[model samples]
Target: MDASSDRELPSTQEDLEIRAVSAERLTFFGDAVVAIALTLLALELPVPEGSTNSEMWHSATSHRDSYLAFMISFVVIAAHWRAHHRVFRHVTATNSRLTSFTMYWLLTLVITPFATDVIGGHGAFQFRFVFYAVVQSAACLLFLLMVREIPRDGLARPGTAPEIFSRSIHRAGMVALGFLISIPVSLVTRWAYVCWIVVPLVDSVIDARKGRTARQSSQD
Candidate 1:
């Protein structure tokens, strides 16, 4: 009895399997949600209607705003999914917080199509534009939270380098900042769209410089 009382138990193989399964399920679910959001965006696309070639071209041109909104949303969702794929690959465990954050992130993704429709609609230009920007920014910020949570909560696989997620966090933050800055700019003029285009270029340059600096520091 005394010997039995002194024995300690180790984690069972089944427990480890469950953890891996949970993480995989979460990732698969996220991917599915993202796919649906993208499909929705396509479904809502404005169909160019006309009786002749010239008419069809004019119709398409008339709905240019709708087409532009669709393009922007499609890119945004694709980028978010790519980043999600990158971070979730390192995740080997799941927790309540991760699940909650992911669900909220997906919510933003789902709302993107609706926001695109609103942005392309007539009237209330600033309000509609800001609404779309806010949605995109929320998606970016939520993803940043997920990236940080993965490593902070020890969800990543053992021996994984912390640096693996550092770049992702930085990218997410920069994208979010771009969207946020555009909000105020939207109030004054439509030139705010330039932020979305310019910020990534700037981030790329910064990232390259940082990489060089890191390399030099390591050499030193």
Candidate 2:
């Protein structure tokens, strides 16, 4: 090849290498963002205002709802990070579209603390519950989109199992469905938070059944 073609080839190859590593860069950035989000969630809990031990205990007891909200949100964010890590583990490359979706997903992740505070401070308000549910559901939806996009964009490494992708999508969808359902349910009753538990509970039963069936099929 000519000198110009040789130079162009190296430049193109360099660009491709950068694109290949983009997913890794994004994953690291995402990990940092999630850590920061969890930290912010903890920071939402206030120090007990009273100076004396008994009085401080009273003040702490008064904010039990805040602590509860913080714990729940922390678990949710940690679950999100785990799911994100699992999906990205198969991803070998990234593009503008994937990056954009990931950024939007992280935006929701970052907003989670604010939503938690809203619900913690105004737990009695139906709208506050709905707002928090909506934020979480949006994050789940965006994550689902990114998971689906992986195979479509050929981002997954060769030989990755189809079942892996399906399960990831299913889990994310179930969580999103739970939150979406909770939104309308919140309007009717203050106990709508219970709806969130349905996702994991149902998912566990379904997973158990699938495991049994797989073992039977293998034996046959």
Candidate 3:
């Protein structure tokens, strides 16, 4: 082999540094955009026109179910966005594929309010239920793509303990599994919304465990 003909790799540290900076910006935008979606969606729902307390109470009370669904969906989207942000913060790559995946997932998220309306208004007809669940599920899958690429840039470097990677993967599995399972359940049960809550709970547990482990490692 002609040594001069062989090309050297770009500086890995330099690539990693640029990628890390871009990933932080992308993740920050993702968080803010999702939050904007929730707020705009909430505003689209109008309050009762009645001026009297009794009449307005009646009007507002009539839409309680819709309000409840909106509240639940909003919280789920917030939790999903928050976890996505955390994962990206630990990432070091922000290449074209990752950017595309984030765009795909965020595009799917933009329909969440419409899905919420369909599911809430029509109840769980198999079609609307499946559609709503599928939208969220697609977002979950795209997020998985974004996260699965995390270990590639030495963030999960040598001497990074196996337990940390294992726990992170396990947490991702919980989210993916919850979305996968909930799709069918949403089609079957009236209370399928409850299943979505499993994701946030899983996130919380993973975050708590991560915090405790880091503290212990630092103490040692």
Candidate 4:
């Protein structure tokens, strides 16, 4: 047989297998990057260097902003990781577009540590607040894009529930909106972080009501 005749066209199943491998690798790399980012955030905490107990106490207290920043960023990173896991769980295959979105999202995750450090070292500055908010908001938006892209890109598994996808995207959008709003709010008041908590609280109440309605409908 001629060389041309001997060549086999790539099968759909083969393509899917390659995509699945790529997606798994991407997720593994994403997990590693997130782990590193969290470590970098923790490292931002200053060592309480002092010879006396009183001096040590003063040093530790002085770094209160760093500690607060570390806690907040840690929680934020953890939330993002959880959301990422949920979204990717439904994804059976990936395309270049989805991969691109994942890369951008990971980029934001990597940048988060620097932003956290800025806020930790200079939390009082409006610029720092806005910068950190922007970084986190970008991460949220990218993840939201990925969540939406999965179904749109035809990467979602056939058995995946549409409601779960919708809820994931909605939650991500809400979180991103909160961060975006906090940017402008930060300019006006130093209490802008309150905006972040407000959105989630409102979402929780709405989700609870939805759950109740669903239960009542099932009972009926």
Q: Against the true structure, what is each candidate's TM-score?
A: 0.92, 0.91, 0.73, 0.91
Which portions of model 1 show Cα errors greater than 4 Å?
Answer: 1-11, 216-220
Give the whole-model CA lDDT for all candidates, comma-separated.
Answer: 0.91, 0.90, 0.71, 0.87
lDDT (10s digit) by residue, model 3, range 28-125: 77877798779766975748758799999999888876787688678768867776765655655576777888888888778888877876674447
Query: Which model scores highest in lDDT?
Result: 1
Q: Per-residue lDDT for 180 in model 2?
A: 91
Candidate 4 off by > 4 Å: 1-10
The residue pairs that clash in candidate 3, if any, are none
Q: What is the lDDT of residue 191 in candidate 1?
A: 88
Which lDDT tens digits does candidate 2 get at residues 79-189? 999999988988888978889999999999999999999998844688789889999999999999999999998888889998888898999999999899988888998
Q: How do the candidates rank by lDDT, highest first?
A: 1, 2, 4, 3
Q: Every model's Cα RMSD, please?
A: 2.3, 2.2, 5.5, 3.0
lDDT of 1 at 97: 89
| Candidate 1 lDDT, 1-220, residue by residue in tens | 8665445223455677888999999999999999999999999998999999999999999999999999998998999999999788989999898889999999999999999999988899999989999999999999998889998889999998888799899899999989999999988888899998788779899889999999999999
